[model samples]
Target: MENPSYWAVVPASVRYDKKLRANAKLLYAEITALCNKQGYCSASNEYFAGLYDLSKKTIGELISQLARCGYVRLDIVRDERQVVVERRIWCAIESPFLPADPPPKNQGTSPENSGDPPPKNREYIKENKTSINNTPLPPTGAGIFAAYAGEHAGLLEALQGFEEMRKAKRKPMTDRARGMLLRRLQDLAPNDPAMQVRILDQSTFKCWLTVFPLDTDKPAAPNPQNDRRQVTNGWID
Candidate 1:
């Protein structure tokens, strides 16, 4: 299930940690996002492995690395037989949703001469509607991207790359242009977010203003022997 409402925060310490691998950092970010709802994540290794197209063993290793760095805590549950049953991972840092510390007691007060600072004489300048339309324009593209992309990080990153490519080519995309580009990308890969990512990445790499259709390729023949031996081992959550 996808949760688009939650946002992840990785503190500077975790991002700059040299001991953690890039994928491990990404996993930490995922954990933080999951923790937003309940202060801890109960997702299994199989779930993360499938999400990232990696093996369960690899996901386990990454989680272990995060635990070893003191960035996360793992709680394991066992039954009467001493068999491992449930596992939960919690972030060590304070929850982002918690209220901030209160301001200092002497904040905004002065013993000798303080009330509010003296108000400066205010001069209201007339609005210039004719020569300069100084009214702030809404951020159209950002809103559109958020609405369309939701919490899909891969798609968002790919779109960002396309935007960067436009800037590098000295033809930065305007809000309308970016919105149109996103619509076109969706039409090109209607049901597939992964395909949309590939399309955007291809256009960015080739510095093309418009996206192109992917080439049609024949499917490779499958081997029955290999398929039969490709069973995944069962893992405890």
Candidate 2:
């Protein structure tokens, strides 16, 4: 993430434009702040949604309106396989709030231009949750999880739901943490994809931090006779 500008700008044209929504003007200011070094903001809709306490769908609409009104330009870059690699929003007009000559890039923690300090307490944690929630999963860890899910559409969907649930609960998991979660789920369900989905869905629905077997399902247990153990009331004893 780029270091946000200390200030924002809303030019007269954008401020007075009757075609834009009131909140869209506010979004324009946010765009300026995020344009710190690249002359464009590359934040994802999810990032903006978390920052403004709005939905990604809503952010997309607002950005579209801004583009339509000539206040910003949207650029979408895709890889050879047609997978989107980046989304950039360029300001149509530069803001006076920006430095005449931009500072060197990637100097986020330099003393003269020190960005956010290290996290200290609950307040600071809450303040930075949005950024943390949007951090990309490490490629190796993510690939392992994807390999585990393979071509099982239901399992893949469950994984995405689990991630969204964590973000919504403000307890986003790191790639390593979620890898541990997947291992735990594997232990609980073994080779049953249906059971895995149920466990994940149950946790998401109940907003629980841990997974549990459904009341109707009996988890396979290690025994001389290969017996199954009953999970009464969906709670493990």
Candidate 3:
């Protein structure tokens, strides 16, 4: 279900509008440049406008739209001039397994072997009554909207990963996220008395740690007087 190919997920700007196409390209380029460099966590649309020789309003609108679509994000910091916005441009790393199935093969089990249409398929076709019937619906608050889930399932992992890289303050697999997940599962589970949250042996906490910093307040380990000697001697509890 996970797809890493750049083409797999439609870019927000692409799905958005022709009006944004040009600015989106320019904005993303600047974002990449800023992230590559050090000492710049927050930036203003003015700075980008000046860089691209465009109006600040255009830059502001583009950045805001990108942030909303998850193509890029903003980080706010208190400053005298204006609130700085750090961009998180969404980039896809290609997966080797993108083309999963083999190419269509000419075989005997073709139009002839297709004896009759499936009953379930026919029933589904009959139920296609409304414009909203078959189409994927947006996620609802009553539950993790099925529409939201289906649309996002492929990128649930990617989104989680990006969140971790961009904002480690909120961990993906931390106790907090896990606790929320467990509570949701409990609410959704059938009313069976024995049902419970089961932690399987094969499951490890490492996967969820993709986006978390263990303890930001904690300092690095102190260097000992016998640092080199300690390596030869195993650590003592």
Candidate 4:
């Protein structure tokens, strides 16, 4: 069996506007592959420059062009390292290009009537369960991104969600609350290096993230406060 593809949805569909368009195959593939990996994900021009083998000036121009077209996002911040962390996510897909018709989630039938034992291979059912309780698969980074395209792309989308929960949902979440949501998201979904760029460019969590991490008193996970911090303070600036 083939390993998860590190590339696909190639020849980035660069949209200058709702109507205008263009394509770049190899460059697109390289960027996609890098995004798929995980390291190159950042909004910082410097980071992107190093990853794509381009100069800072060139990286800046590319970012400007992509942003104008909505194919990339740039979040900026100055942390202790003083390095700007860029969380790029895929606008590479025309930045809302695809119709919002996401594939529907699976709705398993109830087992109360069927009474048959649950399949051993299914995730929701325990190995010794008598029947499926209609439990759904837990929300996972891979699952979230899978709603869009490939595993890598789903990973990218998951980054966006991570940004939302990690940064966007904070109280008074102004454009100054970038947190560790994206980094945690990256940690959870390390399927692609190209994913780093996409996440950094759009919803970067690891590039130059400033995470406060949650305290012990809070819920087990999904710290809204930290997320708010990241989102308000340039989580996706």
Candidate 5:
């Protein structure tokens, strides 16, 4: 009989994270292997969805959740046009056996010890201070939206209005949904201030997650003359 292949090890913390879904854990392991080999994982959402027979949105949600939970960090690379060109995924969990940076030569050695063979630096191994859950918070929706608003004052009121609408409707925005909407907005307008203004003007507060391009031709202005005519004709107060 053929020998069994070497098994991949899953961290106990990852396997036991109650907040982590089974699919996410499996994806994490796959991504961990890729990161270990190449220092990062560059798999697309479509690739993961097809591999696991899940929808692309589900994959995105899982990845976002994993990032929020500190199992991974996603570095989204955008082109000058503000389109996402690549996603570089990194394993955030620290490895127990990770080697520390080597100490500078002659720093710790005395003159008497210089003549003798220097003792091996075993501090890292002895200390082993790796903490798996010490991961920082991933980039969040509020953070990204705040950044956009900082660059574009025109978006501030519109975005705040959108937030109020969501609050009134009791619809909470998830990090994944927020990221998707931000990317879609960027893809639609890039750095065009006028186009972004038009898009926001035409946008309805409902369904904040979906972004649609602005229609051709400018939005029609409200006719104050028509309202006056209606009042004069006793149509309404």
Candidate 6:
């Protein structure tokens, strides 16, 4: 079963910042959604690129912009292998939107404070804590493509070939274009990665970048001419 989605709270002041670009505003919301209780979001640039239809470079730029504007503090965390594993995001703005720190267990109400009973929401607190702590992070964009490549060799070859052709023609694929391709692949084959490769292969063969629903009724042949052509010469006349 799918987990319930959490809300990414954006402060009105930050949301309506006139100085920041529209992309920066949107990126802030995305980052906020992924942040944990400590305002540390561990998502990578590739993840943001895949989610926002932007290039990894663009995501990096936007994050830097947000940092400069005093919205977030970016910390690069490296693993024991000395490889950067996470981009720790700290929300610098002290807004109500930020998650509150959990209170200490031993801090009970004192007699001076009227000895009021603790709020009767222990279950709710436990549930919220579990949800926040156990929430799964999104995979990086390179991870997504790597997974597809591992399972579908033919499709991977087709994509590589297409990229090579584009490069040979001096038509480099833009970040936006790559994002669009990934989006389409996800849309067309959300459940089946292999099917996405097939679609990509078919599209590439036709010298087309756009993907459409496959005609399952038709034979899965490479040549478009294999399909019977109607006598259009007399019909059009």
lDDT of each: 0.62, 0.65, 0.37, 0.37, 0.59, 0.59
If ranked by TM-score, best first, what sequence of candidates would result?
A: 5, 2, 6, 1, 4, 3
Cα error, residue 81 of model 3, in Å, equals 13
Clashes of each: 0, 0, 2, 52, 0, 0
Model 2 residue 109 distance off true place after TM-score fit, in angstroms: 28
Model 3, runs deviating above 4 Å: 1-19, 37-41, 79-237
lDDT of 3 by residue, 1-237 (tens): 121111123344445555556776556544433331111223445456776788866776787666665555443332221111122233221112111122234555553233222444333323323222122332223222121122223223433333344345443344344334434433533222122212210122344432232333359777776676677787632
1-237 per-residue lDDT for model 6 (tens digits): 233255566788788899888898888876766655444576667667877678867887888898899888876644332223445677776544453232234546452232221345222322333232343443244433433343244655655666655666676576556556667766777746678767877766666656777767368665434332333333321
Best by TM-score: 5
Instruction: Judge candidate 2 at residue 27 and give its lDDT.
Output: 95
Off by over 4 Å in 1: 1-5, 36-38, 98-237
Error of 4 at 172 (Å): 41
TM-score of each: 0.39, 0.43, 0.27, 0.28, 0.44, 0.43
Give the Å shift of residue 163 in candidate 3. Answer: 41
Native-referenced Cα lDDT, model 2: 0.65
Which should have the higher TM-score, number 2 or number 5? 5
Most lDDT-accurate candidate:
2
RMSD of each: 20.6, 15.7, 23.1, 20.6, 14.4, 18.2
Error of 5 at 163 (Å): 28
Query: 1 or 2, which is superior by TM-score?
Result: 2
Q: Clashes in candidate 2: how many?
A: 0
Kindly report which residue pairs in candidate 1 clash with one another. none
| Backbone clashes in model 3, listed as residue pairs | 73-88, 164-211
lDDT by residue for model 4 (1-237), tens:
122233333423442243332323333333434332111223334444565566756655555565576554444433332222234434235211121122233436454223222333222212212111122332244332332222233444544555455445453222223223433434633434464434444433443343332233247767688888998888642
Q: Give the per-residue lDDT digits (tens) of candidate 2, residues 8-84.
A: 77899999999899889999988776663435666777677887888866887899899887888877654332223
